[model samples]
Target: MNKLSLTRRAFVTSASAFGLVGASGLALPYYSRANQRPAFTHGVQSGDVDATSGMVWTRTDRPARVMYEVSTTESFADAVRLAPLDTSPASDYTVKRLLTDLAADQDIFYRMTAADLSDINAVSEPIVGRFRTAPASKRDVRFAWSGDTAGQGWGIDETGMKIYSTIAKHTPDFFLHSGDTIYADGAMKDEVDLPGGGKWKNVVMIDGKRKVAETLDEYRDQWKYNMMDKHVLALSAICPTFYQWDDHEVVNNWSDSKDLTTDNRYTEKSIPVLAARAARAFHE
Candidate 1:
């Protein structure tokens, strides 16, 4: 995973550059599109960072040329522009760029620009992000790890992911997502039954939340739903993350030896076929 060390000022500036700031000087989750232009809906992220290089990722609304630019300074002076990569429907409009030949233990500022395929001159607003390379020498490093976002019957809310905001405040070098990033096999409801004849209320109507993710598109939507949270977006901008998957990404306590017929919740009895489809979505 890539490591990142961000100053509070740089974080704020980066958020501003992405047009994430509202009138209150606080980062907002959603933004209006300009003339229906391609926009970075999921924000920017970096990961798989090492001493000499790192990976950056982002998604656009439409097919376009996604350009990756890197700079030593946050101002982007004398920035090195890399070749623009084409994003198509094949990759769900997502692009991952590998930045190489980087300096060790140095803060790196990166940004992305999307240009319309038909008109190269029509470029979207830049989305800025940051990351730091691991030190070449032995050094003490600090990081955090956790998981289970938008899981169970509890879906993401405006304030539910405040833990991510708390995590961002510490400015950890990197974060490890232990598991259960999304419960693709679990169906969400407005309320769930409790032991004492009570109810567990949940925020509902989220895309792909009400039903199981059977198709690849459904599986992808499970991820997109979590990105809608501002806290997740903010944490991603400031902290690099390494992700791992758990059974919930496919099904609860799923294993190669387990029988699909045992689970009444699953309509498809073929575990191998379901696992194959789930793996493709997970890797993507």
Candidate 2:
């Protein structure tokens, strides 16, 4: 492997092996699941592109070894295969592989393969995606920005995040998700009362859809639920993304000094403690 590839692989390997260590000497647990055939439930996403590198992300329904191949050609005749990586419960079966040493100002096609351990011969159908590298030299670029998904009682519907599809139609080089990527702090009711005396329908997935996220699992589930939108998945497959976080990701306008006791939705009164957990989930 080249130095870039080696560096990427080493970082992931070490992280998987040691977990996230904190100043207080506490180690964050890695997510894991019972053995089963691997399945790509959430599709794929590419983001954080530069002249020579980018990040690809995916999630598997079970524990498995994730492999990725990238190429400039659609057929992948001259593809570069990265080192294989593993997914466990620690990451909630998510895998993010970094691709490096890529040509600048070029379109790249990539695909992922998961080898299911429950059955040694079982392998998943490839999940394909594409992205463009940033230009080595200064050049004009086009991109789009949006945020606040499943917010204000408007949850994901079968139509699948239609706004994202509309944005994708413009074919921007990338997308800037400006915060509120998820409303882990907001509740989505099955039927929401409108300001003008009408009802807005929402496709509810769970009973606690109206509760604020308190546990780590709840926060993770909020993300997983948002990915269920097909349009969102479709947009991600083609557009690289630069993601930023906003208050709704934890609580509305939450800060280290904010008081949670005033908010009935928050069961945890400690803003600092909740912020720490929220930050952890956001990074993962």
Candidate 3:
């Protein structure tokens, strides 16, 4: 592969950053295109397990590489770098590493730092999760299902909070996000940069200005934004999440052959049908 070089000035110009700052006081850029300096972006994920190995995934939306450290403790005071990984926009600015020879049924701690600089603030909040290795056999798993989190960007709403609380008390192993997890196209206060609320409007994008989302990236961003809610984040951390999609996951109502401008007749029926499909995907 070829390496791309970029200057710091040209980099921050396109970081397209977001998210709250931590005690570290770093400008964490959540996403960016190629040729931009990654504004302190990272994510921690664990999956694909066997007895002795599992995968650790992280990414950066910046123009440079990132180094990751995995450990068995939150402080990473005793952690070790499995290896250095290159980051780029092609993989959504992330990397997946296969860590081998780890003990089964034990918790592991993981954190990521950029390749060029060490910013403790940029480090993730110590993602410590257990390694299950593999299921012994077919077994019953209990979890909760909720959706239709229709609200604006940047949050959890009253109804959404209540449902999440209900799930917590039930104490299922995990939760299934059945569908309609976010109203990406719905207008809200944040949508119009108002103080409180805004009404739903057709997804729009203006030239030289931010556009209302009507594409896959916009829909994904809606999910990320919604999950930022403290309540939502707590629930996610407490339990594994199974997710699916609905029209609102991408638009208000859509189907295989219908456009956003399609008639209401098609929308009314297709929405449910597409909703079912999204649910099934979540299940699978």
Candidate 4:
């Protein structure tokens, strides 16, 4: 892989847009002088912000060295290249880095290229991310808590929409999402079985054939799909988030020893090792 070299002044003058490759996976439209379609794909995102710096992330499926353009606006026409970072398979083609010298309580815009040689195949959609430098003392801090965001019916739970919307309106300093933040395997309760089916199918397979969330990919997919909801995105974008999880993210009431019996009794068949891996991936 080639190391990316970037200059603040030059990047601002040459690139046409601003974006990043981060957790949000945001993508904005791009225009080119070429007659061919743009090749850049995948959205951009930023995370882990603080007073002096924050981490920016991006995703790319293209097979090549991808370079990201960081800026404060969609039009890189007047932006600066914070750094020319490289992407690799180890991190799932997602690029992340810490940025500095930005103002607090302000939004940042960024974009990326699949490679210097390849066409800027896709540009990440613009994201207005805020950086709130932590207060000197913790005594006067204000924060809120939320949790149990689960299921994916087109990336959102109607119940979650109402709750987060109401929460965002209040403007808290931060949010703590409690457990079960995502339910990877819980499908829509069978209101009525489909004509061709006896019951709904579980999302994943467990213990070789148990059909439950049992792998890291399966678990991450659950989080990715569910978090894609606009309301969820909006809440995270606007307020700093500190999150946690519960059994539904893996299996219902997953525990060790004893009969593992409870009112909402599940088979206790969850693979502990796999469940731990899934939890770690999501927490990251």
Candidate 5:
């Protein structure tokens, strides 16, 4: 990929930059791309960070070659560009890489821009995320961990997942997702009445979360639905997350000895087959 001649500020602030920023200096989610240019579907993510390396990830709307650069400064005055990577149907258009040779105990800013493989000249608006590499010497370290998201019909509501926003407030170096990265087996209704007079409502109802996941695409949608929450997206943008899974990633109390014959919610009655599809979505 050619070195980006345009500065980050000039690129994002440009009038044709797809309204990445408005007069309020804040950006909009799912910013309209009526022109159908390739887009970064989900927000950027980083994880598995160490003293000198970290993993950065993102996904595109279509097959594209994503180019990225790393810098110690947000302005990218001293950026280190890496070889571009191509996203395809096999990987669900998601791309991630391990960034090595980074300075320890320093802020690392990573930026990504994708060019549609079908239309190489049509590029995407650049997206940026930051993470601090581990310290080379003895020093203080901070982090966060979470699990069981949108479980038991407690989906994202109008207030959003406030816990994620609370966790981001501390600006942890990274986050550990202990398990249940997604509640694929927990089908959520539009709303559930509380024990008292209040109502717990799902601000957005996705078809994937409406039933237990059985197909590969449905499992993928389960993950996407969780990221739809504003708080979840905000935390992921700047904080790296190391993921682990639990039974809920496939089904409640799932195991080799488990049987799905009694459960008719899934058309695929084989637990192994269901687990395979869920595993692929989780990995992606």
Candidate 6:
């Protein structure tokens, strides 16, 4: 396997687009799922595709060396293995790699595995994703775009982000998330009263989602909670999502002049400081 020498700049550039379960097979809310073996806690994703290149991303439960392979077929019989990339606490155990020299306008199957840095034998079961590269010549191209996910206290319920599945039905080349990807300031309750004599239940509510995000980990949780949805995970695996951020990624109506004096949930009221924290979480 040939290792690609990655620069810090490259990793920062790829963090905007970000995956599924492997080995543990415990599904999502990976926070509760722990074991000695490394697991692909989040699924795999591919995006930022061009005629001959694209980006792929995934996250693990702990420090590990993530390996990669790409195939034109789903069975992966002709998979070309690439050298592993080490991930650690520095990146919160998340990593993305840019793949180049791919054939234009073709179906690409990517497979990934993780070997615990501390125990190489404790490797993970593979996870896979599919994407198509841009065409070299003129052709019909399709893509989807949307934003404002898991916001306004509405969260993943039993229905599980049905709209994402609807988007995947079109089989777009990629997805553009326009912004407000996570409502970090919007707190959630386990249940919301409905006007129609029923209750909107948030079946899985983590502590991070219970209140407004103030800490860096809390902000990160906002993204993690959205990915816990099956539909989001499904779309992510098959289509690359290019992410953008709005004020919500930091705080509501965030700006250099934004105010937090009236808000009591935050102990640190400095907009500059808070926005800086949010920016890091957004990049990751």
Best by TM-score: 5
Residue ranges of candidate 1 with Cα displaced over 4 Å: 1-33, 192-205, 256-259, 264-269
Q: Across residues 132-251, which tens digit of lDDT does each residue of candidate 5 receive?
A: 888889977899998988889999888999999999999998899999988888889998999978889998878989988888988998988888888988998888899998999988
Q: Which stretches of candidate 6 lie over 4 Å from their true place?
A: 1-35, 256-260, 264-269
Backbone-clash count (model 1) = 2
Best by lDDT, which number?
5
RMSD of each: 8.7, 8.6, 12.6, 9.2, 8.0, 8.2
Candidate 2 achieves a global lDDT of 0.76
Ranking by lDDT: 5, 6, 1, 2, 4, 3
lDDT (C-alpha, whole model) for all candidates? 0.77, 0.76, 0.47, 0.51, 0.82, 0.78
What TM-score against the true fold does each predicted structure earn?
0.81, 0.82, 0.50, 0.59, 0.84, 0.83
Of candidate 3, the 10-residue stretch with the lowest lDDT total is 1-10
TM-score of candidate 6 relative to the true fold:
0.83
How many pairs collide in each candidate, listed in order? 2, 5, 9, 30, 0, 4
TM-score of predicted structure 3:
0.50
Candidate 3 residues 1-284, lDDT tens each?
Answer: 11111223322222222123444665554443333334433234455554456666544545334554555565666555534456565544556666665654434555545532232224322344333333345566556788776454433433345566667666555567777766655544423344566543313222211334444344445444554444565564445455566666545546555575444423565555544533332221
lDDT of 6 by residue, 99-215 (tens): 877778888888887877766656677889989888899999899999999887789798889999999999998899999998888889988888878988998777778987788
- Give one digit per residue, the lDDT tens place, for model 1 in 2-40: 333322332323434433346798755433357746788
Which residue segments of model 5 deviate by more than 4 Å? 1-34, 256-261, 264-269
